[model samples]
Target chain A: MRMPSPKQTLAKAEMDMTPMIDMTFQLIAFFMVLLNFAETEQDARIKLPSSELAKPPEVALESPLVLQLTKDDKVIFGGELLPISGLGQPLSREKRFLELNGVDPKEATIVIRADGDAKTGVVQEVMQLCQENDFEIFALRAKQELAEEEP
Target chain B: MKLRNTGELSDKVDIQMTPMIDIVFLLLIFFIFNFRIVVQEGDFNIRMPVAGPSAASIDTQLPIRVRLTSDDEGNLTGIVAGDRKLDNFSDLHQFILAQVGNDAGPDGADNMEVELDCDYGLKYRYVISAVTAISGYVTADGHIVKLIQKIKLSPPKKPS
Candidate 1:
């Protein structure tokens, strides 16, 4: 009698990629949620002077001392006119008042908002007085669109 | 058991994956779709002066600032200190130095701080000149010198 024919072998294999695909999608979602574009737009119009040691200001929006300089050389503080000279005395007094009321002076920052047409002389004068008053942290206001213009 | 199964084989087997090919492709797609590339430029059309960092951090109490502007003929104009009108660089520098020298805080801190707000249309050379003059006000003895920080270059705004 002829020997039984060799049995044909059957091969069966399958891969389940559901776990890997799920992990990939999760990673994609993480990056999408954390990106920020508003920071680039916040100071577009303000042209900050370049310095090797210059750094971004550390002040927040609520407690900063806001100073605005107009093209006509008018100095506005929190929407009020500030005398061009001897501003340090009054500002220091204000700081003292804040401290008395429980605000920390070191946590306070001065914000400078100036027009492009403002003169260099005026800017220098303001800077000098701020230095005298001992205000350490400062923020320069600019439009966000302007920052994007740099290469 | 009718006829014994002579040729039957197992019907299921598991295969291991290549492990990282598809993950990389998905990552590449995610970045390409979500990335934001931007080039920033200021709306103010002014050139700014350069300066080194001050030796000391300014005091937080006194918030003195100077505002600079130019007339149609490019003549500098603005308030220097103490509400006085300033037309030239010499007066500006002297006023700054004096203000800083005499600054006395409640805690007896003599720290000084300054901000420069310059007009956008002004020339770069003029801005530099002003910065140079201001630097001289920082006394060499270190007793009268304070920090000059925050130079703002922007366009003039209309009064409200």
Candidate 2:
């Protein structure tokens, strides 16, 4: 019998790649779902501020209250154009979310997503309303770095 | 002795997938890294002042209310701290230090709260400046010492 060379012996007929490819596709899919490109409460009209001093929360805020304001001074909550005077009504509902989780409303956080050009007064009014509702924590949504300043 | 070549072996072909797998992994890493960049746009953290409408008496000293006013053309004209009008943010910081006193510990203003009141028509640049002034800035030694740790937004002044 003639001896086959080492090169010919080393060549395998097949290798299974199904598992790795499967896991890779799963990872890609998970990232795609987590992207949430369209379904955020952040309205394009609302230009956020930037802060280098801003730091990420040590604890994650679960289901935070979102208050969106536009440069035109139109405050929108729950898809309704909430008047400045009626800012309290939305919080009455937001507080219920904390209550459901058995967390005190005072301990919950409220995020103020305001436009860059939005009047300071409107932003303050929203905060005041959150205060009246007993929500103690407030997060002013802003770009943490200068890199995030791109439109 | 003569060896006969195997036809089946010569005809069989196997595709090499090492390069393809390597490329896919690179793509996977790219997406994973890009994920953090995308998530950064939406959320930021800040604290609220505890002195609300109902709790005025709870804390005797309220936060220093800093009202940011603008000109008719939407330019930042003045930074009003209580009844006194400050020339700029530097003055604002000096005023805060004067009011709170630089104890370098948990001895000033209790919670060291500040209320930032901005205008609706003004750009966010002015508001950001105020926030930075109130929250403190990076010193020459790269240390971040805050004038006030707790910050709140003042209610909007209703259109007269």
Q: List DockQ, one per candidate, in order.
A: 0.10, 0.34
The reply for model 2, stretches above 4 Å from the true place, is A1-44, A75-90, A146-151, B1-8, B11-36, B39-63, B102-106, B109-111, B116-125
Deviation (Å) of B158 in candidate 2: 1.5
In model 1 chain B, where is the ten-residue run with the lowest total lDDT?
B41-50
> Residue B154 of candidate 1: its Cα lDDT?
33
| Quality class of the docking in candidate 1, CAPRI style | incorrect
Candidate no. 1 TM-score: 0.33
Q: lDDT of each prediction vs. the true structure? A: 0.51, 0.70
Across residues B1-160, which tens digit of lDDT does each residue of candidate 2 receive? 8889654556557678888889888878877875733435434345555454445324535667888877766689888998899999879878877877754446565555677776655566677667777766565555567666566665556656
Which candidate should be chosen as best, given lDDT against the real structure?
2
Q: A117-142, model 1: which lDDT tens digit per residue?
A: 56545655665566556554555443
Off by over 4 Å in 1: A1-62, A102-107, A146-151, B1-160
